[model samples]
Target chain A: MMIPTPSALAYVPFVSVANMMRLVHSLGPEHFLSELAAYIEEDFRRWPDFDKTPRIASHSRDGVIELMPTADAESYGFKYVNGHPKNTRTGHQTVTAFGVLSSVATGYPLLLSEMTLLTALRTAATSALVGRYLAPEGARVMALIGNGAQCEFQALAFRALCGIGTLRLYDIDPGATAKAARNLRAQGFDVTECRDAIQAVEGAQIITTCTADKQYATILTDNMVGAGVHINAIGGDCPGKTELHRDILLRADIFVEYPEQTRIEGEIQQLDPDHPVTELWQVMRGTVEGRRNARQITLFDSVGFATEDFSALRYVADQVRGTDFHEPLDLMADPDDPRDLFGMLMRARDA
Target chain B: MMIPTPSALAYVPFVSVANMMRLVHSLGPEHFLSELAAYIEEDFRRWPDFDKTPRIASHSRDGVIELMPTADAESYGFKYVNGHPKNTRTGHQTVTAFGVLSSVATGYPLLLSEMTLLTALRTAATSALVGRYLAPEGARVMALIGNGAQCEFQALAFRALCGIGTLRLYDIDPGATAKAARNLRAQGFDVTECRDAIQAVEGAQIITTCTADKQYATILTDNMVGAGVHINAIGGDCPGKTELHRDILLRADIFVEYPEQTRIEGEIQQLDPDHPVTELWQVMRGTVEGRRNARQITLFDSVGFATEDFSALRYVADQVRGTDFHEPLDLMADPDDPRDLFGMLMRARDA
Candidate 1:
């Protein structure tokens, strides 16, 4: 019997989020979310194969801009993102992002996509993935503080991935809470709009603080966070942007994406530099126990890492293949004679 | 009397080299070269106003890639470039680059252009600018070593800026020499193809070395160099990639764009860490001397820096405005509601 060899044509075509969304809608959001969750989990399992670094950030007066770059042996990926807390006052999203994926062997960019939408989706996916292991079993109610642009995505991801069915939302800006409630209602979610953080946390199994203040304002106090609650803190992402009170952090068993990055940018930045925190990967790898007791409070202090973007880029690329949503960009030159760079220009001029 | 306000449209549109060449060809190359040289000189005089740093580079097995970023309070610029010495053997360009200029206040990308061609132009322009200050008055001939992709541009810029009337050229690859000779002859230059490096430098007032090897290969030795020669060392741009011998550096008064960078990536890499060198800005500022005596050999260790790209970007953006050569690029989203990034996506989806 003759065996057939795998052809070079086995490569998946790249998919932009616009294209991926259409495919996702066609596949139904529930199925797509499940597949994305699986992809994230699988990637976390092979985390050691990646070349990782705490992102290179350039800070400005108003906010901070950062480039998070990572690569494995086969592919390279990076995201350009910014955070300006005061931006929302001017009716602008506090966070905006874009990313590029390239082939490591050739160093040629294969896909360039507007990552603003994908970032929201991936952050939610990662939180949900962590929640699967760290959250209390059959957790159904989440207290969501700071119901801004990312609130609906977080609620939907939890509802779909962790069987969370109801949301208790609170925001300083009542308009933002209303907007989040409207968006979640459109997505078939049941939300209770609360007047205060304490009321929002009442009978909640998960407390998610996604506020956008640049300063260390406590959106969550220790008295508000109850036992067996998974605190998904997302807003306190920079050096001075803490949302949860110090007492709450001291009380909860914390897990982070990357310890070095979390120590600087995550909620743990409020704690001592030498404070013990478990890496989320260790929990996923079964090296550390997560939510070991029924009443133990668990915290996923996710400030977002490059590895999550890498996984998102990989999934988006795989999903976009054979779709009409992307254009082949002339980002790299594949000249017949590479040394004759001038010759290529001369030809372009002549043509 | 009522004073009329100036039109509030002072934005500069960016043009890539391909488009700039079209605009230049229409305006004439002589005018473009002279104007660009003037702009470079003017920017050099105000160098203290700019923020400068040595590029952040990522090294790989085949070659190295780098991100050179710089900014003033008004504008920010960065270039992504890669140098793979073995790339040409596999039908790829040894150097490939692209750059972007953005508004510092808004953090919006204003221009995106291919820099593979512009790099050659800017590098040549920089060399000629340095030669104008360091070379002996009315120098007429330049010995062009390593007649490759960049040789013609150097020759043209020198001819245009420094009153260089003749060229003496030599390269290990005879075909490259022939190509350079043919191209220069078309441009009405007096070209002499010499047998070796020594013969090429025998009667020249300036010697320009631009060979592309990724090792410490001495293309120009101290014995081959003579007194009063202004050497434009252009090719040795990474660690372990020096062209001129150590003794040559010892004999010459080395000037560099950024000393911190040149110490590691330029020909000065061969010298001691404590070796004395002058920054070119200081020379332009008259704080340091360029050439004290006619017999003093001066070297412009031109590894290339980010500030040069900033100058070039500003120059190109200014020249392309009010012309048909550039198309307005929508690289950044200026939503009426900046906080509603998701709203922008919804708009795009609806469109």
Candidate 2:
């Protein structure tokens, strides 16, 4: 049988960094986060349908590169990401990412997208989605420690998803705190710049830490976190990198995206291997309890997972359906006769 | 410290299928094959330096999609490939591939290229390279039992690398044999088209079987393969797919790329679990002998490996150094302040 020659079918829709930013702006940040949260929650509620595996990582002296793959019955997705904390010193992003979505039936890629911006949006959405379930009632204030790339996204996602109206920001670098405070003030949020993590947590109902370090520095001490507070920990996402003290994990009701991954790369990595932690999917599925009482501390030990990236990909693929925000990438080779690949190359010579 | 904004450095060089074919033609097929053979040999001699892993595959009812990743001290490479045996019936390729080469230190992709043509080239280069050592001295004639997409390339590679002057082509379909014969005839090789497998191996010092089927079908039987003939078996690449009869395997001294991989997906799968087989790398390194006698039957059980793909990517990255065969793909996000990713997004509003 003769196969069809090259056409648009051979091209995958690719969302570049410029297009991603344009799409995010076109959708508006708050609305985009809310919609992303909805997609994430829907996928989490059906988490059992996914083909899940811990990320395959290639580590180096300065950083780590990872491939996170997941698939369901209909579609497959994977993310290529890197974490190089020292990259910031060289004027490079500490974290950069891209992803692909493919059709499981035909083994063809459907979408390729820049996930650096999407990852920030989705991580914030996931925190906000889980916060709606675990955060205390009438939670209107958040403590955002380590004011870096992910700080402002967290503040806005919490505002859009959980009705959070104020942000208490802190960073080891005062310049970073000032930058975050300035950005949030423009977004119409009541912003507080704190001198230390202790001051950032004072009188705040939710605390989010997202520092950029490949070490085990405790951003939060056991004494800093009070009862009835929810901790959204995002920075401690690789081995030997953690933000919370082990004693803090003991006093909190821990929630994670995937326990197998969190045990190796999340804040819980500092704890015992068999430490009891509830999966956020179980909490979303209503099969397990999230927050026990008003006096209990809740922790969402957020090490990223493949499914969330898959959700973000699916979201972008869905949103860009009728838009020109994507370019077709001529990535796959299509020959007229599938078995006549040589003939195809020969014909190209004549052309 | 403030980082530089996005620029061409964030763009990866992407070579499309058409560009790849143009490259092959510009370099001349025979010379390109010889150069590829050299690169493959150089990488094989230092096989211990590579970080190797068996491909990760996701299988569906009709096919399988796979990711093969490998890295050395300086560069990392991976190929995204698919195998759908039934795709030819519906006007699609049974195998299509694309690959990326990245900087290990920076975690930045250096090149992205269509690997369909490259895979065909690399596979043929590997077989010819191995045949130079395993085939009997002064072997000029080769029996190409499956005259399909890969047949012409194999014939030319053998001509370039092993000085083979003649090709005897055969396939179940007469049209496929005609296509390969026509292609090879234009390349100035003395070509003979045969009716069946038995007639194909007549008076040939080398036998190459590369049929496209996903079953345990015997394309080569014991009596058809005589003594002193080196067989290059290519198409048996998955768990249940094999080409040669079990009896022929018993008589031939087998050489494989990787034992752990070949044991699961090569012609040697028919043998006992502990049956002895020499690694081709060892043979290339001169630690193990190949074709000890003129009367010995040597077989190269070829199930493509990750390092070979890495070599191909490295070769392409090297060849496209100062050429315009590739377009710069804006794939990475570079923010002015590495920690001010949200600010970057916010500034996009003014632009």
- The top-ranked prediction according to TM-score is 2
Quick one: best DockQ, which candidate? 2
Model 2 alpha-carbon miss at residue B283, Å:
2.0
What is the Å distance of residue A59 in model 2 from its true position?
Answer: 0.5
Query: How many Å off is the CA of A324 in candidate 2?
Result: 0.9
Give the whole-model CA lDDT for all candidates, comma-separated: 0.76, 0.89
What TM-score does candidate 2 get on C-alpha atoms?
Answer: 0.96
lDDT of 1 at A296: 94
Q: Candidate 2 at residue B20, lDDT?
A: 91
- Model 2 residue B252 CA deviation in Å: 2.5
Error of 2 at B225 (Å): 1.9
Tens digit of lDDT per residue, candidate 2, span A99-161? 889888777789989888899999999999999999998899999999988999999999999
Model 2, total clashes = 0
How much is A316 displaced in model 1, in angstroms? Answer: 2.5
- Rounded to one decimal, what is candidate 1's iRMSD? 3.8
How would you class the docking of model 1? acceptable
Candidate 2 residue lDDT tens string, B76-120: 888888888788787777788888888888788899899988999
